[model samples]
Target chain A: MTATLTPAPEKAPRRARASSGASRRRDSGPLERQQSRLFWPFVAPALLVYGLLFLAPIAYAAWTSLYRWDGMGEMEWQGLKNYWILWNDPNFASSIVNTLKILVIGGVITFLCSFLLTLVLREMRAKLFARSVLFFPNLVNAMVFGAVAGFLFSPDGPVNAVLGWVGVETPPKWLGTDNVFTLIMATLIWTATGYYTTIIMAAVDQIPPYLYEAAELEGASAWQRLRHVTIPLAWDVITVCAVLWTVSSVKVFELILLFGGSNAAEPPMQTWTTAVYVYASVFPTGSVPKLGLASAAALVSLVMVGLFTVLLRRLMRRDPIRY
Target chain B: MRGPKIVAAGVMAALALAACGGSPSENGSAEGGGKGEFTYWSMWRADEPQAKVIKAAIDRFQAETGTKVKVEWQGRDIKVKIGPAIAAGKAPDLWDNAADVVSTTVVTGQAADLSSVFDSQVPGEGKKVSELIDTKLVDTLPKDPSGSTKWLVPYELISTGWFYNAADKDLAEQPKTWDELIKLCDALKAKDKPCLASDGELMWENFLTLDLLLVRDNGAGTLAKIFEDKSGAGWDAPGVLESAKRMEQLVKGGYLIKGYDASKYPAQQTNWAQGKAAFLSNGSWVAAEVSTLVGPDWKMGALQIPPTKGGNTEVNVSLIGFSVPKKAENPEPAKRFISYFIKKDNLEKIATEAKNITPRADIPAPAELADVQKQLSSNPVRPVLDNLPREYNQKVLFPAFLEMWHGKISAQEFVAKAKEAHVQYWKTAG
Candidate 1:
């Protein structure tokens, strides 16, 4: 999400230099001048809308984080004490660790699977149909997955009943606290890999078919072709995908919240991400709402997303490869 | 082509800007109503039995008082909406919720004192609303900031206990002590039946065994005090430690139904109703919730947590009650309606149609809840956990017990971790 901010600075200087070169030539046409004249008028509305709808809420959240308000009473100045509470909170610490696990561990597995799927898929007939089949899960609501998992993995549900039929009397508890996160990560990867694969495959399609033909003619293996051609060609899309995953992984809430169909109360602390932490703090059942504490947690997550987005962009920056 | 595309883009941007500038219309307006009416937001959905009972009462209340009542059937999480509404100075004239939730969400500033409503006589009962309900149950309602003025007038009561199939003659014998309870578990397990069924993901359902153990053994408010202790040393109390040890026994003894620790809400409890298990530790509402699952052959019965030495015998109760917000434009009519609500005719539906316990001791309970109702009558009542702070309950207390329940740690380890969390909480919370 923070990638939206990084591109503007990089593009501004290049645009300025091009316009300066055009001015030096004194060759600007009536069309170019008119377009320039319309630019501000065209863009002003979008900028204003973005400022009000997007940036203003973030600023308001930052301001609210410094006060101790429960949404009902007078706002008492809490300053940074709310953040201090979060820093000391063991639950909050685990929540951050869980968020990072989704970003790093889940990211690696998902990207690797997506790349492999994209490569094999690029060589196949009916690849479009296969890609659509793979992407089907992305269209389903997350609550459906959570509910299906509860049914499939219930103690005496189908999974265990099948194991019992096989004479394996004791199946591991799939939704146990020790195992729930692994299941969640696996589900996330299963649903996400297809999306990344589709995007990378779209970029891969733009590469000349002769590039692969030429590689194969020179005795290049599939792995060598993928390494030398496919990845380099699709690097731009992959970079965007990584940044998308980072932001999304940090914001993973509904799957974990409704995991195991346990929405009657808060989900297990073991499954909480930063998003879940913010939500639980604000709308806790049988407890007072802590808007200030929730705002602090939310700001911390926003900063994490910003830092990670910038880091990913810098690491992935490369000279554009022309076909 | 270029000019048209640019115009289209500009129009889209303008439309987006217009969309951003529009604000949500104020909804469920609580004031500026016709003179004879007031607004109420309820914590029950329109289709729920509780809502039906209340709807009936509203019709009767309107007929008797000639005052109109507008109700919005906000579901269980009504507090989420009520918080912002109260903050915006648009709170409904009256609302109802669990005492602890109402205290934290509305009573802090918005709840009007309802002590006067308590003293006013009911139309046909020839008694004040306060006189109708047990004084013990009345004391459990949330009060104003002054600590002496009452704010909530409760109509329904919920208490937790072990619910079982009364038709199971072999399980008819109730355990009088914790050891006997374990013996019964052993007997059931020998017959290939689990003694208890509990959902692991719902932290409160899992925590109930410990909560009841601590409260029933030491007294009500024991768990609350342990949570309030800033030093985190409260876990060292004999009652607290002993409760943990008892929970450890349930885990080690394998008394919980297979996969109880991994099942979801209504799953394990449904299993209990299906006769896969002999007992379910849950609130009184479980009978109503799983009534469909249990066939005609099955009958529901409840047993209190077995008492211990020096234990308080009083029931630990939670009240779901009505409160008039302080900014209410028609507090008198709302209060008057509440008095009518507790009348014998209206309150009886809570027990009959809703399958819940009514706070009015004069009203008989549903057949399934007679034991729970009898306990409420015979014993004085105290609020559960004395209304423990939500942060501590959810963040610190629940995880500690959860780890123990998952069998990753022993009872001693549970106490140690809980104590550490308590100390860390205060260090930052201070």
Candidate 2:
């Protein structure tokens, strides 16, 4: 019995070796192993959700654009007629102009304010307190902020009241007239500065303290440090933010809807961005449903957004900087 | 690692559990199945006492039918909720909406055909709907320019006219003619009170008032021709131009409240309610809204805008209504509910709760609505606003009227612009 047990123990090593060899063969190459194990495990679920929720819907919208559908009836194929109509539509042209204005003017204003705010926050002695205070507006929802902002700039609101106290007889209507682009841009700046500042501040903070010291030793002023050291180091983050802001600003609806200040359909038609125009086409004032036209409008807007994203990406190409 | 993975697994399990638990009634059946429960969504807010009344009615209905009912308050913004549901094929079984909305809802096939339901429930079962609602108004619904009855059904009837303070003895009692109304404005102006306080943001209301003036002066057929032909040549008609000229005079005469261009409907209404202005053009619904602005002590009266020749003639009424979806899950139940809800007793209940006028001719007018009914009954009820095509309403008419009101363009210029816009709208819309 002792001899048999000893033989069994000796054979266990051989069996273990054989099993280990087979397992190694199963997991031979890094790429094949990753495909079998890590790739599907890490990526499949997210890809499935994204494809189902977003990509599929976008694909469907693209398909729908080729047809004239009134939402409830049988869809009729219209080929490129809808697109042809959109090309000549004045509202579509105005929407494009308005979107670009928001992107360029609003983008520049937000970027400058955010960068300045970050610098101010970083240089402040009470950094934590200052940063918290600066970042507070980011916590408030945009819709709520829009309401509060509207009240502040209303004809008889506190801003005008303050202007009254200052003995300025005529205060321009912030919400009225056709110059709503200015008001919208100002709102965008006010809303986005804090959030972008936080993002930029993180990028700014990641830079080594020694870089600034080196700049100082090289006889650089504060301005020079920002221009030469800070900005260059934060270029990647700034570009990313710009790209994000461009996409988001094009899709802005709630603020314009709420504070575009009634008589929404007519003049100051220039105030309507693509997103607002699309929304209005879908759900116009009063009670006329134009579902087919609205769907067509949405398709046009998607194309515009896609074209814009590609153009922006091409224009804003920058090497990723290692800090 | 094993412990953390177990915690992550537990979290995922919890999320999965929550998701599974969320869809308890996807099949539209109420829990317990002892009694059938139906859900009703309304534009009324939860805080409104009317919502409570609606809930009470639901409860009463449930008790009578041995089915449970739930009333959900969706607030005044119906578009946000209803639009999506209509798109998704899950719209509410019953809803309250303006008559204009019914036109679009019907055209899009979102509204259920209630012809049979109307026959079974309404008192005048076989009567032509045009006889109940103004036939001319039914003609206004969007069609292929071939005149089709795309939609029909009205729940409430409201008329737009000038409402004035009853206590203000200085204000003339319901100006009978355009000239007399202007004279009244002059008198009010002399008394250091504004003759009219209006919300410019509601460009449509002001335009409707102007349209009514045109109708009264040019005869009712003028606007109908314009809508039918999609031309502004009708706008340049002698009586129509005169009406625009009259509007300009009123604006120049300082009859409107201060900052009229910037003010919204609520603000203008409040201004009138505060007695800052002696008159306001609005619907009968304002009686309730005004009571909230001022106190119950402020007595109110309505008057049809006078005709051009000082005659007690043309009167127009605005109607609001409800429509059922064509693809409703429970069509029979939906029809029964709508029919029950619009019956005389039910109509009175809703009117009392909503503090608005009921459309049913059989029901006696409530005390607050009696004056409006009396004024409107003397003349033919006409749905002026609803009698125009969607494109005319949105593109040509409203924008041009707004420009005219803002003093940016003369009435002639307004007419020219309107004609161009009308042509453009018809090109696509037709």
Candidate 3:
């Protein structure tokens, strides 16, 4: 036992020597040169795939956005006129406004609710089970939610049926054309909060319990501990969640398209988002498709999401704290 | 170094293989691989009655002609996919849809001109297909966007009108004019029953009423002219304001069903079928769509949209039929199939089994469409909205009309908004 305790004194110098050897190897040429030599071999496959599948389509879209083509006809050189046309289009303007509303308003509400849920579930006995229950909505397809919401909010649907039973003579027109976009935003928040809360809960689980107990000993309230420790410690995950929400919100198409639950090819124009505008423009029901206009609209959305992601990352950037 | 070099070679080979992967299958599926085989993509789903009828016909045609047909039941979204397919030179040799949709293919120069098919005789029927079909419907077949070629060979016709439950003998007296129609609605309202039940969110369905009013008050092609006028000067046409005012009166007069503004498709139509409303302004196909809901109290009846001054009393018709793509590998087999498809025995299935109005005048219309067929025979037919571009109708006209119908604006305000929006629409259309 005495010899085992004394081995630490002998092990310290060996550890120091091992670290010095590692640093010496880093200072030398062989390891770095080997990594450089292997770099292309390791990266070339992924680079080729990414360039072909992702960047190439984006480039093609940008190129086509300049010409007025009907997908099967002669290409007319419209240059920047397509963009100018979109700028003047009132419907396209409405789509852009709707996209931004989903990004900002929907994002804020989702994150706030997710954080609150995460905080509550952190102390729960069945935290794992509770987290799973909260995340169940994400597992369900969005189309189901749209169809169910359409049924629930119909004038004589079950929601109103319940209201009637409760003696509420006049229920709000929940599926009214003016109310559709707001309802869509609510559905999005409802579906998204659960997924994000689970992610935040996972991040919170990594936090050592001793920190909370230490804060408790220091007379810190739950809110103050969260404000000081939980947020900062989980800041990276929250940043990632923000980026995910921004991209998904801009691409919110199927929900808006199917919200009213009719087989009608197009939804009401009042509820169009940028993605819906792109789809409807490209594949209008009974008119010649507008490929050029649709390409421009799609690129506009891509650029918007890219900008949002970058801005979010920048704003949420913080130095990572070590354990 | 050797290991890295080998890995690089492997990566390049993999990329090269990946690039080559998309070519083989694409080339293999090329058309005209066999003279006896031709591909067809239908606008109907596999399980629909129309598809079943057509499939039975296809089997019969194959047995008789020794031609093999490979068919894909692409359903309605085929419109969205067909363009790309045509662009890629992977389109089916034969396809069918509503005439207006086929005209879109014609507009894109994808649909082959079928005048020869029209001149060709219906197999064993001893009559030119064109001669057998309704002349008015053929005359109104929508031309391409350039207004040159006719592409659609119509087999079925669907017309727009006011549908009612004919079981009520008192409702048998159809209104002959706009005023009488309003009086009928007013009487129904007095009885605390709704007059007209429409799917307000369905722009095309609601558009039928406005288009009829516009065509009646002004003339045929007036709505088309309104869209074609790049300067938006056509909004100043008196018929435009008159039609707006009439629609406004329908809105303000409490004649429409409650919550009609928010009604999704088939909701109010169901209500109409149940006799909750006196009438529904809808397509003739409403009978077929709601056939399951028909009870003894409900007998489908249709009335021509009441005529107005200078309306020309023209009937609005939509033709659903077949077309051969310009890029088709075997146009002959497709053409042969189309002719066989229209044989008297074969074409009647559209009416008997599918519950639609057949394009052939020789075939009797379905019982539900007796009144529509009678009207079609008597009146000169015109394409829906005088063949207006659907985008213009959906975007510029629908917004103003919806606002008015929702009681958010008056007819005067409708005219103002429509004019302003019409001008804005054309400003950048170029």
Candidate 4:
């Protein structure tokens, strides 16, 4: 019995020796110094950039938000007065609601379309060609795409021409109608889905081939393998993308401005988003500059985006699976 | 990735070199020798005939005065580029823009008070802009209630009215009255043709029509009171309702081009130019655009909207100008340039090249601009959409007018909503 138990004692001594050696190295100044040297070199550039560009501007905006000054005039300290005005501003409220609608509705539509496309591509033998075709729209800039879409959707445009071919007699005004928000959402989805599908496909690719092989060996069906492996593996990236979409959709302006020529000015109240509202409010088309109010509005928008980001991240949180 | 990196490096190098010596400020200083160069911005490009004429004058002035001038030509979207520069404290000394944008510029305090410059220069320029530019139009500029000029100098005067295809000489010669215009529309319609083509998206054109109708029906004074004074009761006046009723009748009669409600500027103008429509209501700018659609040989003529019963004489002029930024690095040079540019000789050149009438009374009118001149020289010189308070012009008036054009809202409903919006704007603004 003593001889049998003594076989494990040899292994334990070797493990202890290895642990002691590791502890000694950790205690040595040279190893710690080397580790810090390697870490700082990697982090320095990123830290410098963040500090100079993002952090500095955000900090300045916060400071400026507390002042009551026209951008050109002398600064007057106003504490929370600007913020108070923003709370009371009806335009600000409308913008917030509009932005949320676009984000939620547009994001859902985009995600569904991209998700289905990704699955179809993943299953198909012509995946490479199909993926390339789907990704083509993403290569065009949003401004250029918005202009082209405007032409296509205009009253005497191709859409109407097609309707005429079918003898519809009267085609619905796609862009000129008061309910332009629907058109805007449709455009956002059309422009965004291709790029997002590609991203989702890449995420799906990361699901281990071994897992699929194992499932197949176990006689698991294609849908069953996808449910078990693909969804779970790619869920994290998809969630991150959703959060990014929320932020981007809220700030969408180029397309709206380009399509809605600066002076059309219909749908008076709801035509603007937070970004457009801030611009219009500060610039206030055909009015004086209200930079202080604009900055305050910007601060309010930042807070809104920050809160949503936090909530979304919390909603997306999950225990990591160790594959 | 390597290509991008190399390109970025080159850009950085270029930027650094630009920062050192190629900056406008440095170039300006060197060229002007401490007197400083004036940076002038205009919504006209070098490719525009107007720009070429103006540039020639600038070259002449520079040669004679030994003052260097730098101009930044802005395209159609003047505000987008100008607004950023203004916010960045890099605005030009002088900027040419429409009267509609004057209020915004003034509020920014970006415009310099040119009272002294005006007093000294404009009188001697032999144009007497104060007389040539309708006083009612000048009053439209953003100002303190106490009578302080804030932004803009009255520059290019434009007349807004109906432009008709000379190929359809019958419709062009007739329609001297509101009734005649309606009859003309009906006559065209009877022949299976559309009488009018309008860019529904351009709210100002619609607003211009309403203004013209008001002047034609009630008198110019009533029209002035409605816009210049916030007299809301005027909307209930017979002239206002009559104009609205006429517009509604036109809509119902199918006199407007098919799908005119959703048609774009180019499309509507193109229709008129192609002789598919008998009439296009727009400002003097149409001549240049129309030139592109129909050759110069296809005659185009401007005509004031036909008058209504008990109406005053119809008069229309485009209200446009240039302003000096208060924070401009070289205000003196800007003032000098404004004076120099608006001289009789320069104005004549601009009128000839642009194919539009100059506001200068002394400038010899170009033969090509005779059609526009005839329209401008008509009685009552009404300023198109210039008299509305800035807020109303932008927020309430334009949108409400657009709704009427879209046929989504009735004229009566538009008037009611517009009044409400105007009151609300004033309340908030006050």
Q: What share of the true interface contacts does each candidate keep?
A: 0.41, 0.10, 0.36, 0.21
Better of 1 and 2 by lDDT: 1
RMSD of each: 5.9, 11.8, 7.8, 8.1
True-vs-predicted CA distance for residue B327, candidate 4, Å: 4.0
Best by DockQ: 1
How does model 4 score by TM-score?
Answer: 0.82
List ranges where model 3 is wrong by over 4 Å: A1-26, A165-167, B1-36, B145-149
lDDT of 4 at A223: 73
Instruction: Report the C-alpha lDDT of model 2 over B116-135, residue by residue, as the tens digit.
Output: 55455443354443344434
> Can you give the lDDT of residue A319 in candidate 1?
50
Candidate 3 overall lDDT versus native: 0.80
Answer with 1 or 2, whichever has the higher TM-score: 1
| Candidate 1 global CA lDDT score | 0.80
Candidate 1 C-alpha lDDT tens digits along B1-430:
1111222223223333433432222333332564578888999999999999999999978887789998999998787777766666567888999887788754457678888988999888799887887777767655567774377888899987889998897688888888889999999989989999887767776677788788766777787678767777777887788888999999999988888777766678888889999988888888888888898988788887787664576676899999888766677788888888988989899999998999987788999899899887887677766677666777678878888998889999999998987887778663
lDDT of 3 by residue, A1-323 (tens): 22343455556767999998798677867878788789999999999997875666566667777988777656799999889999999999998899899999999999999978877887879888888888899999999988787667777888889999999998887877788889999999999999999888889989999998999899998788888878888988998889888877877888988884366457877898888888777778888877778777777777777777897776776556677
Better of 2 and 3 by lDDT: 3
Candidate 4 whole-model C-alpha lDDT, 0 to 1: 0.67
Q: Per-residue alpha-carbon lDDT of model 2 for A1-323, expressed as tens digits?
A: 22343455557777999999798877688866766688787898999987765555555556655766544445678777667656656656777787778877888888888877766776779877777777787687767755675457656668889999999888875655344567767777787888888888898999999999999999998878888888878877887888788777776766666555453343335467766655555555444544445556666666666677787665665445665
Query: In order, what DockQ does each candidate have?
Result: 0.35, 0.09, 0.27, 0.18
- Model 1, residue B409: C-alpha shift (Å): 1.2
